[model samples]
Target: MSAPETATPTIPDYAGDPNAVLNDTNAVWRHGGPPNYSNTRKNWEIAASFKSFLTDWRTVDPNKYTFVMNGGEPQSAEHMLRSNFYSPLNNDFESSHKTFKRMMPTFAWEVLEVYSGPPKVAFKWRHWGVMKNDYVGYNDKKQKVRVKAHGGPIDIQGVTVATVNGALKVEKLETWFDPLSMFKQVSKDNEVFIDEDSA
Candidate 1:
């Protein structure tokens, strides 16, 4: 008996709109398929709205409201932007969004689980992408060698906590993920290996 041939997954085509790319089914993959939560899972539109806010922060008017992001770090009332740490100070949405876009130029989120509640909705998803441009630390090594690009597909799981108003706009979002693992993968793909023996 011959084995059945599996179909190859095609890269999503997004007509130049960065936010539209997330809607591509071919780009998203869930481990056990999509989870079936009570209210949130059944409400497909909520998921779509959540995803839209993620892919495009501008989807919501920033001048009208502020968004918050927490990366599982210690709680702080202030919002600050530092070179290190994903947990930027609250209220620095613009800088944070700019930083995020610069780091992950080409990316997609595969939603695995979602929980909708009053004033807040949370979802667990996988963030997958390729580093097409040089981003901060990762760029230093590539730029020194004059390399145009670095890093392969990055598949990492993360959880996002968001507050959505009645208007369906994301008022705040908090995310948690393993930064060490992400950086390690980027380092490997960029050929910026560290000598463990020397250390």
Candidate 2:
């Protein structure tokens, strides 16, 4: 029999709002084949929709939901933005968002596969976006770093392990990915922008 055809992935538009998109948004891998695939799709969509950036994608209980990124210590969603967004960039939430926004305008994400299910879920994912502009960031040393745009995609992969409450609302979320890999990509030239204020 001929191989079943798979539909091409269409990422979420976010329409300037997804906080959002490799986001192939299709991470779910389509449906109608297996029950597990459906479950996997549900979990992936739950993650993409309930992200801390903007639960705007889906309505989540204020008291029941929070997206926390774990590096060393767990922190609130807003705090995650303020923390080392890219390890080298140690700026406030707003500043970090602005810097990263300019770096990857269409940073998309998708699910690779699901390892387990229910209350506790584990999965692999991929995020990629084209570098349309330069990347500006602050290192832990409080130094300014700028990398010219390579006009290529800064692709990243990571794993998220989360626990859901009775309602399937993620109560605790944690993700692990190499932020330095992204840094190494944009910093291939090792170009550094001096801190003029220090002069």
- By TM-score, the best candidate is 2
Pairs with steric clashes in candidate 2: 21-108, 22-108, 22-109, 23-108, 23-109
Per-residue lDDT tens digits for candidate 2, residues 11-51, read 33332223232143433322311122221234334333233
**Model 1 Cα displacement at 146 (Å)?**
8.2
Give the residue spans of candidate 1 off by over 4 A.
1-58, 61-105, 131-151, 193-199
What range of 10 consecutive residues in model 1 has the weakest lDDT sum? 138-147
Off by over 4 Å in 2: 1-71, 78-90, 196-199
Index of the highest-lDDT prediction: 2
Tell me the TM-score of model 2: 0.61
* Per-prediction backbone clash count: 3, 5
C-alpha lDDT values of all predictions: 0.46, 0.57
